[model samples]
Target: MSVDEIIEYLRTLPKGTVVRVLVMDKASGHLWSSIVENVVDGDVWCREDVGTLIEDKDKKPTPENIDRVLAAVPGGLSAFGDWLTQEGWDILRDIYDDAIDALR
Candidate 1:
């Protein structure tokens, strides 16, 4: 799905969903509860509470931080999707499936 569609779907979720959210800077990470707001240009817009851990360092979220956050979430779904866009579905799927199975 397009980022806009994905964001729209996220916006429709119920409150308190245990979404694996992360906010970070070049050097640190924080986790939070999140929902999607909208997409602007080519980037996905996420609506999330600033995670206390991530915010304690006084850092603002950045694209690189978003990438790092996505990469570390479980099911590896978001990372897999993003990687599939750049590296092809087959490769990331193989990697993701393997990671998922290993976790079980």
Candidate 2:
């Protein structure tokens, strides 16, 4: 799929809404969890540890001061799908996964 297709896919989910998603590695059958932060432009931001979404300083997942995604690799949307293209991974929605799947 093209980057736009992936971007379009990201656009389907509403911003600020907690969701359970999965990125499956086709080679090892390994699964990784992620939080899709901004849908417009930016690395596919995600707080790997959902518990830390609202850091000690913040008590809410407001995206401004709460969502603390790292500044390094996993930070942009294009980089996301582009990396996705490189990794041969697939993204799926699992509504009943776990609390950590949520953005909040």
Which predicted model would earn the best TM-score?
A: 2
Residue pairs with backbone atoms closer than 3 Å in model 2 (clashes):
42-76, 42-77, 43-75, 43-76, 43-77, 44-76
RMSD of each: 13.9, 16.8
Tens digit of lDDT per residue, candidate 1, span 12-86?
989866444334332443333343434222332342332333456676655555566656767676665576467
Local accuracy of candidate 2 as per-residue lDDT tens digits, 1-104: 76579778878977766554557555643455444545332233344343265555466644444234433437555675587656542332343355447647
Worst 10 residues of 1 by lDDT: 39-48
For candidate 1, what is the TM-score?
0.23
Off by over 4 Å in 2: 1-4, 36-104
Q: Tell how far residue 74 is off in model 2, in angstroms.
A: 38
Can you tell me which runs of candidate 1 are displaced by over 4 Å?
1-53, 78-104
Error of 1 at 12 (Å): 23
Task: Quote each prediction's TM-score.
Answer: 0.23, 0.25
Deviation from native of the Cα of residue 35 in model 2, angstroms: 3.4
